[model samples]
Target: MALQHGVTHLVLSAFGCGAYRNPPQHVAQLFKQVLMQEYDGKFSQVIFAIYNDANAMRRGDGGNVEPFEKEFGIKASVFKEQ
Candidate 1:
């Protein structure tokens, strides 16, 4: 595990939300629960990187923005190149 190896920061992808057929919102909520409640402060930072393609854009929402904001009480930021 990353924690066992003394990893401070973690870049987490959307687990089971794609080919595994798991619900995106549910998976986001579960990740928040485990990271915040179960493994509180274990990592210096936890980043969720969601990639959006044409198909995902067609679906309107392809990332965990709302779920993550609701769970963490903060908004996720998007970095754009100028």
Candidate 2:
């Protein structure tokens, strides 16, 4: 639907992973699979903006970017706390 409407970029949040208690790693993998396999080359860019809150920072949630970088062979630019 989005692609059909000429949407070139996508920003995704962690769905079902916070209050819904879904596994973060599994959700990430599913997104990777769909994007790389099903919608490969369809989007100009895709971004996953994982919120960096107190709990996420404490849990090293930034590590979630690793698998996506590894799978896509792209380096991620992380914004650090100032």
**Best TM-score among the predictions, by candidate number:** 1
Clashes of 1: 0
How many residue pairs clash in each candidate at the backbone level?
Answer: 0, 0
Off by over 4 Å in 1: 18-21, 61-64, 80-82
lDDT of 1 by residue, 1-82 (tens): 9989999999987665554545567777788778878789889888887644333344456544455566667777766445
Model 2, residue 46: distance off in Å is 0.5
Task: Quote the positional error of residue 53 for candidate 1 in Å.
Answer: 2.1
The residue pairs found clashing in candidate 1 are none
TM-score for candidate 1: 0.70
What is candidate 2's local distance difference test score?
0.70
RMSD of 1: 2.9
Judged by lDDT, which candidate is best? 2
Per-residue lDDT over 2-82 for candidate 2, one digit per residue giving the tens place of the 0 to 100 score? 988899999986675554555567777888889888999999989887644444334465545554566557787778767
